[model samples]
Target: MNETAVTAASTAPAWLAAARAHANRPTLRMRMPFVVDGEDVGSVETVVMDRIVEHLPGGHRLFFHDAAWHLQSANGNATQAMNTLAQAMRELGLNGPWRNEQLVVCNEDGKRIGMIERGLVRPLAIATCAVHLIGTAPDGRMWVQQRAFNKANNPGMWDTLMGGMVSAADSLEQALERETWEEAGLRIADLQSLRHGGHVDFQQPAEEENNAGYMRERIDWFSAVVPAHIEPANQDGEVERFELWTTAVVHDHLARGEFTPEAALLLADYFGW
Candidate 1:
């Protein structure tokens, strides 16, 4: 992890500066193709990674065979082979309520290419979409959440008020509404001034060897104002706790490198950096 402090001299918050630094870092390219005995079976995404071989769950292994990175599997059937990989991830305790969430697959241009399980997407290196809701109160304080300790990705890190992948069957609105209610106990009605903020393209090397090999996603960002009277109560167990922080405090954490990379970017974008 790059701990080099994003210089505080800039007008932009330190968190946003750090996010920019992360955005500029180099990535290792990887291919996720389930090849058995030298025959291609299905969809393949070029995964950007920090390393090639990771120690993720299950009995899966990636090896250079026949001049390519082969995700070795016992099952030759394509569906079964993918399942084998998903099962392994579950075993590693990466699976969550969003585990089987089906998300539309896309190329770098955001084209509707196909669909895949959310939990399996990273392992397969497929590009997917997600929503992050930046909630603010009338007091001008922003709301943030601490991710559950068991989360498969960026566990225990600070995150936007709400975040979740846009599943294959869901519209952008539906994914946002669902995640808001589930993660922060906010119904669509509780959120005011709802608007599409923007998007962030994030890719990074996997942190733990037992985690999904690479982290990649296109974040569809949203911002809203919630009633000061309504405190965000988490319905799902994905959040550890919620904190309402002044803008300056957030910048401090970002400078200290405490926020999750994605959340830092989202916060920075929301603040108009």
Candidate 2:
């Protein structure tokens, strides 16, 4: 390999690497408006245009209004509105049992603004909370997992050892503990300190994988060291395998755009890059 390759592998920051991976990915510019009791809250993309049109009262195509897209509604019940939209997506084959989890909704500042069904949150461009845990072995190797090929989003991509969206009812720490046990089969208390390593706020327009209009997320990052004697096995089938990689190896994958953008961000933060 040339010096450029070596330097790129060694020096690239996680955020920059993730940005580069998404730099070439296509974004859907058009946003279908989401309104609640006349208050425009968010927008969805064209992927679910048919479903929205069908369920909307008048079957009106989304139109631009006040610099945002919107659908007409007579009612203002948030729960009913969310349930109706979620059902639409489900019938259209966009969401299912596993992907249709509950997620915490928040504003840009990361406050507990509201709650929504996870499957509809993305399309509506609602901000959601996610937790990522970085597991490190005593000898300095990072534990990473490959997502199962059948996952709804970012399938077949490399990801942090354990990560999941936080439900509306779960706190960040609680979500971390549950996700850790589910994804890696490790009880939180069995590991070393689950240190708070800061966070990453990611807001990007919808890409191809996001049939939902966009992805706006606030991720709480954590790191822990796993003893060599302890092995991580996947309880949920979302992960295919787990392996230990050096910092350099991780960076190389980042350069190659192998890790999911969210995973890249967590790993980058973990490496202090």
Candidate 3:
């Protein structure tokens, strides 16, 4: 092992280190790739694979080949086939909370290959995309929202100003706009100095449902300045409330683990922490 490779973590803030540790679990190494039509997409835990083999209908067709689970019959009508599989998983109690929304599934090269129920993404380890926005005031204070207690994942945790998954039917821009308006009641067009701040890739054993699934997603983060005259109101029930905090307070919250892991990582990167 390279001895010098381990010192990088010492340079990052303790909060960021904790966030990275939370987002990248060692259990991910135990999962096998989920292959579809000769394309490597997603992964499956051994336990999950076993459950599928024992409880899923037509599950016998899935076979282990080249160290991965190969689904040969999922070639045509990929979307329909994936949806059918997701529904079957739901029946077997292998899925997360169902959203009735479709999330686009992409291959290793980021090619859109299919669409599956949002709830099934974590169960199947399918990589999905989301948009997260950081709203800031001219005085360097940040706007954050508290997730509703009823949320399926990370309920009641503080998050970025606005964050949401990119549905199969919506583009990145559309998702950003929709999430911003719905979660914070702030129109994207009205924000000042809006800019995309790249993205963060996250993968970990799902903690929300007792590790019954895995989370693999790419979060596209953005930053903007909200006008002092404009106040954020929750137009959607997904948010419990919104609050603006100074930089020092935000850092303290992060250190004390008040923010969600995703938001912590994003904010850490934003502040170069």
List all candidate RMSDs to the true structure.
7.5, 5.4, 5.8
Candidate 2: tens digits of C-alpha lDDT, residues 7-70: 4344655358547456334345766556544455566655566555555443333444665555
Candidate 2 weakest lDDT stretch, 10 residues: 1-10
Checking candidate 3 for backbone clashes, the offending pairs are none
Which of 1 and 3 is ahead in TM-score? 3
Per-prediction TM-score, please? 0.72, 0.79, 0.88
Please give, for residues 1-273, the per-residue lDDT of candidate 1 as tens digits. Answer: 001112222467534655776764433543455443344432233342224346533454556555445555454433444455555546555533246666665545465544446666655555567899988787667788999998876789888999988888889899999999999999988777788888988766544433344556779988888897789999989999999987778778777777888888876766656
Q: Encode model 3's per-residue lDDT on 1-273: one tens digit a residue.
A: 011112222356655765787787755447888987677888887677676654434432466888898665533666766776777678778888889999988998999887889988887788888999988886667899999999887889999999999999999999999989999999998998888877888988877874367888889999999999998898989999999987768778888898888988887767754
Give me the displacement of residue 135 in model 2, in angstroms.
Answer: 0.5
- Which parts of model 1 are misplaced by more than 4 Å? 1-10, 29-98, 107-113, 209-212
Local distance difference test, each candidate: 0.66, 0.70, 0.80
* lDDT score, candidate 2, position 211: 59
Task: Please give the lDDT score at residue 123 for candidate 3.
Answer: 72
Using TM-score, give the best candidate's number. Answer: 3
